[model samples]
Target: MTSSTDRVAIVTGGSGGIGRVSVERLARDGLAVVVHYAGNKDRADETVASVVDAGGRAIAVGGDVADEHRMGAVFDAAEQEFGGVDVLVHTAGIMPLSPIAQLDLDTFDRVQRTNVRGTFVVDQLAAKRMRAGGAIVNFSTSVTRLQIPGYGAYAASKGAVEALTLILARELRGRDITVNAVSPGPTATPLFFEGKTPEQIDGIAGANPMGRLGTPEDIAEMVSFLAGPARWVNGQVLYVNGGAA
Candidate 1:
């Protein structure tokens, strides 16, 4: 097993939102990190700075999550900089909501590419290259169970993620690498707030028994666990939602 301080991680979407917080959390846990961004180099750099400021090692890399070559480069960077990647916290995805009937085919395809294909790209690389005793935490949404009307495209995309995550865990048998997904319910991230109004946010928060939106930190804590210590926990979608059902 890699010592905690010697472990390294690649956090896709580490530029902003939950991914950013997860990077910080993992860094604090003593892992060198490769912070990935889709288009926000500045945000990724800032995330890296935060880790570096805290006396951790980190570097920011930008790429399209669904692009194999680009994502390959991300892994390459992690290897080049930190020796090799031990954990992959794949929090990079899109949530463009529209009722199924109203959603355009183009938008639907984009959602699939970013969410499903992106997951495949990164997970495939990690499955092939990540060190044993590492973990993969793929992001999923509780809306898949919530059956929210306008979330058709987004939810469907995450459904694919769930399936891929489960199957990969089985396929990686005997590798000592744990693969799992985190299903978050109404986390207070920019993605969740994209088209939501204040009232809508309030209503969703009220629905959760906790009566508050899940913060990025809340989700990051779970990421920290799955990546660092949850060795026996594998092939499950751990719902971090505050019992919003």
Candidate 2:
């Protein structure tokens, strides 16, 4: 089991909703966190400030998680600031709503690039750099099970992530590292509430068994545990929704 002391982690997309929460949680858990943001430099700085204010170590970095060179620099930052990365939490992704007929091939390619290929690139870097006692946690969505309309392409990309995670775990069998994915149900993020009115937001929340949208902190809790001492759990897709799915 890894101790929550002096460990280092790289959280891709660490500036956004769930990513911010995960970075904060990991930093609080005693990991020197590298906050990876594609853009949103202000938000990334805010994440770093929040962690430092809480007496934890953290730094914000900008990079495309799908870019091998960028990801390598991220790993390098983790080592330069702290030591080596003991954990990786990839939460960077894009979701575009469209029916199969209306789905833009350009958007589909971008989603695959960011979601599926991004996970692959970062996971590959983690696998190569992380020593024994390391752990990797990925982000997926509960849409795979909910089969929500307009999410066909998005869910398909995440499905690839799920499969990659499972296979990668087995590929690393006998190593002390564990790879897993987290799938959250409808969450009350900007993405979820975007373009929706108050009534629509309530309606969406009402559809969930929990009667509410998920909070970033809620998902972060699971991420914290998975990346921490729970080394025994490997290659599992943990659903963080409140029984919504």
For each candidate, give its TM-score against the true structure: 0.99, 0.97
lDDT of candidate 1 over 101-123, digit per residue (tens): 89999999999999999999999
Question: Best by TM-score, which number?
Answer: 1
Candidate 1 lands at a TM-score of: 0.99
lDDT assessment of candidate 2:
0.90
Clashes of 1: 0
Model 2 TM-score, all chains together: 0.97
Query: In model 1, which regions exceed 4 Å deviation?
Result: none
* Ten-residue region with minimum lDDT total, candidate 2: 1-10
